[model samples]
Target chain A: MKIELDNLTVSYQRHPAVHHVSGRFMAGEATAIFGPNGAGKSTLLKTIMGLCAPDSGRVRLEGVERQAIAYLPQQSEIDRSLPVAVLDLVSTGCWQRSSWFRRVDRAGMDAAWQALETVGLADFAHRPVSALSVGQFQRVLFARILTQNAQLILLDEPFNAVDARTTEDLLELVPRWRSEGRTVIAVLHNEEHVKQYFPQTLLLAREVIAWGNSAEVLTDDNLHRAVDTAAHWLERAPVCHVDGSAA
Target chain B: MTLALYDLVVSPFVEFGFMRRALIACLALALSSGPIGLFLVMRRMSLMGDAMSHAVLPGAAAGFMVAGLSLPAMSLGGFVAGVTVAVLAGLATRFTSLKEDASFAAFYLLSLSMGVLMVSRSGNNVDLMHLLFGSVLAVDDAALMLVAGVCSVTLVTLALIYRPLLLESLDPVFLRSVGSRGGLWHTVFLLLVVLNLVAGFQALGTLMAVGLMMLPAITARLWAANVGAMLAVACGVAFASGAGGLLLSYHLELPSGPSIILLAGLVYLVSLVVAPVGGALPRYIRARHRQL
Candidate 1:
């Protein structure tokens, strides 16, 4: 599905979190929404998912039901005390297809199992998700997304707190999804990580700084500006995002 | 000693019609709230339940004013108020990205204050306490009927939407992808909560109502290993609190509703301290065992 944000604007009361930004996310591609801490990256994706409606503009999700969008929020948003097993979590994907109180049918169960397998957690189906490592939990969430079989995937900081090996494991799912002609958009904090994985990127500092291929938009000017030691409000001198160590 | 505990328990059921009705309705409310409470706690929306409970005050007061303290009128009024707050709160939070808790806190406090102000103006000061604390002993046939009706409807609604509610609570993003609108599910669950409190407040009272809703479920979390078991334990504990509180209050000539709520709180405290694995006592035991 093609998503075009025609001068999208969303705000918290009067303060605009996402300004009049326009962009296009083509189908069958990976797009990274990258930015500094308060750059409205997540806000843009949230507006796209209809979680937050635009204040002054429109988000045209050209070819899907408003609810057909799949999103994986930051892992921190999940409740740690939840008692659901990995299998049970995956079964939530079949919810729209089933009646409210009905039991998971054979097909639904199969779908849950299939999702778990894709996330490589089929063997741990019965394990409580609360028992998972950070990476494992993220995958379990991805399993939820996969089971949704959504046309567009909106991921907000999926790689946060995940180790390198797990990051690779998760990133590998993108290409496979791309092969199936699905759209994947991720919010990345690490600039180098975005260059390493995503083919297309949108850079933001509460506005669209640059948008294009990672190598092209990730020039030293943009990189330096991202780290510009101007009279600023955040952590001291944003680190050189050229390498993982400084990033 | 001559009479078994079973016979003793049956004495109330056989002796008093009102007690039997209260017991039955209490049990039903307990069952209805267990699963919903679990999800609320998981979503960190327990306070939302509390807010919804308190939000019913104005509607209840209006109903009682019109119908002379009757069941249907009060519940209908409270249901309207409750659903309104739920819907309004949902809209306020999502539209503004103001934290859900912040919105809930705002609505509940405002409604609570509004309720109190109105009650004061109407010269119903003494009766207002009962609104806050409840009068379980006063739950007669009519109130019991209301409770039963509410329980059936709320439980059925909850069971039907169980999958989406649980999914959203645990993983809202995933629910959205599977054709679930976050606002829609939120509004539905909030409505169920409104109905539960409306039906239950006559017996449990608003203050005690949300407390009872949260206490048993939270206690159960410290005992049960999974969602199914948590619900089972929550209902069991709620029933135990009702039965024990009733027996103790009858023996002591105290208020049944407050006694039951206090007992629920006691159960929560005990579970917090003593569940075998998940509670503080269990952790202490393991530490002691290691030291020994």
Candidate 2:
């Protein structure tokens, strides 16, 4: 599906976190949003996903036959200490797809199992996520995404800090998603990965500083500017921190 | 009616009319409090319930001043006042950039002092005492109906939004993705809490209403895993505590509300050390055992 975020501006308490940003992410494209520490990449994604409202922008998902969207929030969004089992964690993804008030059905459980299998978490399906390694948790999150069967996927910093193996596993999954006609958007600090994997990029530092092919947006000059000027101090909106572990 | 054959268990529900009334009130409090309390603990709004319950005292006194011992009229005034405090507290949290508990504390203390002043100025000792300790035996049919109606609305609303609410409580940002309005749900959940606390205030007294809501739910959390099981266990314990306390109070002829609250508190105290999972001592023991 093609999604458009036109003139999107997200502000908090009169301070503009995301100032007048516009962009379009087409279907079957793996889009990467990158900036330094504080650039409003996460804020922009939040606005687009309808988590936070943009002061003046419209976000629409079009050109997709499927009506479903799967959202995989950053790892920081979940409490690591929570004793929830992996299967139950994935089952929550069905919250959006299933009807309200009704309990998760057999099909939902089946989907969760399938997603866990896809994420190589078939064995950890019954284990508590707290027991899993960091990479395991990320895969668990991916399993949640798989459960939704969403044509459009928005992931916030999927590869924030991980060993090479986990990164490679996730990097390999992106093209597979694109091959399957699924759209993926990930916010990241890693710039080289953009050229290596994703085809499109929306580089931001409080605004869309550059947008186009990965090679063009990941230019060293644009990269430094995005990090030093806009991103150096903006990502921690305080409102977005679930448990004060924003760093 | 042969009173002797039923005398052992019948007195609580049948022998003395006042006892029957207290027992029934306890039943309502128990059921209403279970699901309500579970969410409160899960959402970290236990203290908010306390703040709101205390905030209504001044309003309760105001109601008494206006209506002169009229139950419905006073309850309406109290309910309005409680809802106002909850909303204002929410606004203070959202607008002033103050933390939620801090704002709740400020509002509660202010309301508490004001309530005490109003009671002293406008109400006599007996009215203030009744409002504080509550006399559930004196609860009329109208009050019973009101509690029942509020319970039905709350239960139905809770049922309708259970999954989204659970999802948000567990991981709100995740809920927000794929089109969940976590903020909106937060407001709605808080609203439900206010309504339930206010409804139970008549039987529980403004002072003890929060205690009644929190203790059983907290205790239940110690006993089980999963939202559904926690809710059921909480309700069971809440009803038992309320009913047992009611029967005890009636047999002994004391204030029913305080009795029920004390009973709920008693359950909490037991759960605090011995509950299956989260209880402090039991958890420590389990950890030590695992180490061994």
Candidate 3:
């Protein structure tokens, strides 16, 4: 399903993290949200996921319910030290199928197992999540997303702190998801991975610096502008009152 | 020797009706509070549980002032007060700049002082002691029934909300993304905490009520590797501590509330040293083996 952002602005305490920017993510398009640190990439994703309310404007999901979207949040958000088994954690993705009180049926369990197998963590299913390394844990999270089997998938810095081998292994799943006609939006820092995998890119530095074709968005001039805009940001800048002027 | 062992343990529960009632009440508290406390410890809200126990005081005191030592009045009051404090803290955390722990601490301290003052103004020192420390041996049929009812409701509710509750604790953002309101589960959990604290205050008093909840949960963390195992271990510890504490109080003529809590505390300390999971002795042994 396509997601349309209509002049969205998300601010924390009056300082806008995501300025008024409008865009649409087409259905089945694998897009990389490429930006420097603090460029509102995560905030944009969160707003789209309806976790953060926009200060102005709105997010419109076309032909899909919010529940049909799968989100893989940053690792820091999860309590890895919790005494949860890998299988149990992965099975949580079947929550939509078996909401609240009902037990997950045989099919759901098999899906979870299949997900674990896909992530190469099948043996670690019964082990406590705390016992897994960070890379392994990320895989387990991916496994959970696989169980979710959502039409729209949002990944917020999914490859951070993961080993190169694990990163490559997980990165392969993006194209596979895209091929399956799932819309994949990912916040990523690695330019090579972006250029290699993603056909479309949104270069953001609080506002859209560039959008569309990855090669066009990742041009030297655009990349320099993104970094320069981010570096020269004023912390106490006045609120944007002029409509479309700031954009 | 066998007869002596029986006298030390089983006879107190078999012979005296009060002791029997006290044991049953404590078991009920243990049964419910163990799982609730496990979640508290899991969420790193063990101190929140303590704060909630103290927050129950002013309401129980208000009830006592109005209706004497009536079970229904005091429990209702305690439940109301505890829930009010919890909700206020939750709201403050949501709207204001104050963090959750700070808000809870502020509210509970205020509640504690107010409760102490109210109790002292209306009743004598002995009555105040009974309110603060509880009288497990003096538990009547109504009080026993309330505790049992709270326990049953708590278990059923926990079972109903178990998956969402776990998701809320472990990954709140993910829960929200998947269309579950984590705050709803959190509020429900807080309600359960208040309900348990109200029931516990009847038997263990406001001061020691959280002891049976927290101590067993913490002790279980030292021994168990997963949530289900942790829950089982916590309930087991709570049961053992409750029965042992009752026996200790009976044989030694100690106050029942402190006796129960102290016994739980003792178990916690012993578990800290010797539990197989993360306990000191096991870690030390593992370290030694690595070196060897």
- Model 2 TM-score (2 dp): 0.85
Error of 3 at B19 (Å): 0.9
Candidate 3: segments with Cα more than 4 A from true spot:
A245-247, B287-292
Of the true interface contacts, each candidate retains a share of 0.68, 0.46, 0.85
Please give, for residues B25-90, the per-residue lDDT of candidate 3 as tens digits.
Answer: 988998999999999999999889889989999999999999999889999999999998998889
Winner of 1 and 2 under TM-score: 2
Instruction: List the candidate numbers ranked by DockQ, top first.
Output: 3, 1, 2
On lDDT, the leading prediction is 3
In angstroms, how far off is B180's CA in candidate 2?
3.6
Query: What DockQ does each prediction reach against the true complex?
Result: 0.45, 0.36, 0.79
**Winner by lDDT between candidate 3 and candidate 2:** 3
Evaluated at residue B111, the lDDT of candidate 1 is: 79
Q: What's the TM for chain B in candidate 2?
A: 0.90
Instruction: Residues A37-154, candidate 3: write the lDDT tens digits.
Output: 8899999988888888899978998888897789987655888889888998899899899887787888999999999999999999999898999899999999999999999999
Residue pairs of candidate 2 with colliding backbone atoms: A38-A231, A38-A234, A38-A235, A39-A231
Ranking by lDDT: 3, 1, 2
Model 1 residue B131 CA deviation (Å) reads 4.8
Best by TM-score: 3
**Sorted on TM-score, highest at the top, how do the candidates line up?**
3, 2, 1
The RMSD (Cα, Å) of candidate 1 is 6.2
